[model samples]
Target: MPPMRKWTINGDFLTLSPNGVARYGREVTLAIDDLLAAGGPLADGLEVTLATPVGGHDLPLRHIRTVHVPEFRRPRLPQVWVQLQLPRHVQGGLLSFCNLAPVAVSRQIVCMHDAHTWLMPESYDRMFRLAHRVIMPVLGRRARAVATVSHHARRQLAALGVAREDRIAVAWNGCDHALRWRASRSPRDYRNRRPFVLCIGRNQPYKNMELIWAMAPALAARGVEVLVAGEAGGAGALRHGPNVVALGRISDDELAAAMEAALCFVFPTRIEGFGLPAAEAMARGCPVIASTADALMEVCGDAAIHVDPDDVNGWTAAVIRLLENPFERLAMVAAGRARARLFTWRGVAETWLGLMAAADGVPVQAPGGRGAASAAPIVAGA
Candidate 1:
């Protein structure tokens, strides 16, 4: 029998609100569970457990154990638990999918999804930024390994002095979850609705939602409405216009339907770790007009019509062109689905397994004999 390998996943994300980071953690965890159940060399003698705070949500995992750590009642309980208490319950190695991790854990891998706290400081509140600015660098230096979602993000982390370039591994986020969404069961009936362009993101400054607001009038003039999803807080002020529908937070099924039926999906974010929404849009066969941000460019590649985030005119033109041109739209949808296929949850899990094994000083190779120490290479144009 192979030697026993024990690892605990930090389940802090399960207690947080659903977002890109949380989604990545949840999906990757599930994928890892699926891989273990499938049985393979990587899964051999591997014992995984998800350690969460007492009230964290549960996941349907087959091959991994789940434990809830008792937390001391305190301010910032989640942060406190992860940094102080959770580590006490861990046995061998730790895996943190979210950006924050126990800085003291030397035999661990923390997936810092982005360098947003440093690069896009204004997007986050002061305390949040300061916390990350301090904690991330420490984790980068102390952890056995670091992982990020995109090559662009990996470069950003290294450039910002968060981690050495060599210490970071790139594990791209998967889009296959969108494929599981049942568009037919979408709650909204779109058959009689006006032709609309769909946009989804929080109302953060870096999300560049203002650009969409600025172009809403022009899109409406062309008899196209704008459907916005996932906005909260101050975005309610922008929800007044008839041409713009603020779908403040929606189910995946609803989003899948919106993407499938929309004229196109527009993502004008100023920065991104992996541009997950755009990737998910592509996975749903939705043509995308995305920003030329480095990560977006890398993820969307030739699959999307790229535009400057601040270019209102360019965004308007792209949306209009896609609406009027069936051939171009069809071609783009085909390209997008093809591109999205290159990213899979299984691939990401494989990368994480390799990183974990390598970090633990185990001699393991990926299915293709790639050294476990070197993560999966970035997919072409991904």
Candidate 2:
């Protein structure tokens, strides 16, 4: 029998909020777990365990192995811990997803979600931005491999001097969460008594929140409410325009309900790494009216009515056209569901496995066409 392999996943995200990165980390690990259970690749397979600086007891996975690092427990000292302490504990190759990896850990795969800190600096705090600007370049060059969520992000990373063009790989986000929620009977938290268009709240201008707000009065006149699901605080979430209702801090099931029931899931973000929400919406059979953001284009493909993020008029027209043409909306919903199926955690796990195999000097092929080895897209474009 061949020797068994071992790897450690950076489980710091367990302590953070259930944001996109944490969700990605959890879903990908779970998919890998499922794959291993079925005896996929690496016949002398990995003995994978998640390692964390603090509490990771709440994660659904059974592989968590917590480690104590007093300095790492504090929010402000994360960088210090990663740079100065994490290397000491990584017994084998480390898989550091969600944007930070130990600089000293050469046998590492660092998944940088996006170059957001550079693209949308105003959206983050000064310290956070500064740390990423400093940390990513070093990690990009030092780590054995660097991965990102989208091609746009891979391009931006190179442009921002974070990673060399040849150094990064793409690992797309999966849409299975949407599929799960769609079939589940979880509570539907959104109150959309009227037919509505949905826009998720990101308290930043680049998300083109202003466009959603701007078109509110017109949408209301058409008996269409503009439902904005936002962060916890309703009032502080966004500038509430006419007919806009804020459904704040919802559960996955509720979000799925909103996406499933919405007339059109509208995403007009000016910039994004991988537009997960839009794909999730599409997976739930909702037609989408998305922005021309590069990542949105990649995720939504021809399944969406792609408009200029800044074009309030174009968004308004698309909404009206969809509301008026149920046939077109139905066609779009069908197209979107097909498009959404392309991004799966299974694919990500397969791709990571491919990367791991490559690292071990064993060239392996990933499952889906969207895997790192192929030129296929995360979604089929028109």
Clash list (residue pairs), candidate 2: none
Per residue, candidate 2 scores C-alpha lDDT tens digits across 79-151 of: 6766777677776788888898777888989899888788878988889888888888999888888888888
The TM-score leader among the candidates is 1
> What ranges in model 1 sit over 4 Å off?
74-76, 232-241, 366-382
Residue 341 C-alpha lDDT in model 2? 78
Report the lDDT tens digits of candidate 1 across residue range 1-382: 7578999999999887756899999999999999999988778778999998887789999998999987898445447898889889888999999999998788899999999988888899988998899999999999998999888898999999999999998888888988989878877876578789988858678998888888888887899888888863235634535688877788889899888888899988999999899989999999998887888888888888888887888888888888899999999899889888888888899989988878767787742321112222222212
After superposition, which runs of candidate 2 have C-alpha atoms over 4 Å from their true positions?
62-76, 182-192, 236-239, 366-368, 371-382
lDDT on C-alpha atoms for all candidate structures: 0.85, 0.77
Q: Considering every candidate listed, which one attains the maximal lDDT?
A: 1
TM-score of each: 0.93, 0.90
For candidate 2, give the lDDT: 0.77
Q: By TM-score, how accurate is candidate 1? A: 0.93
Give the total clashing residue pairs for model 1. 0
Clashes of 2: 0
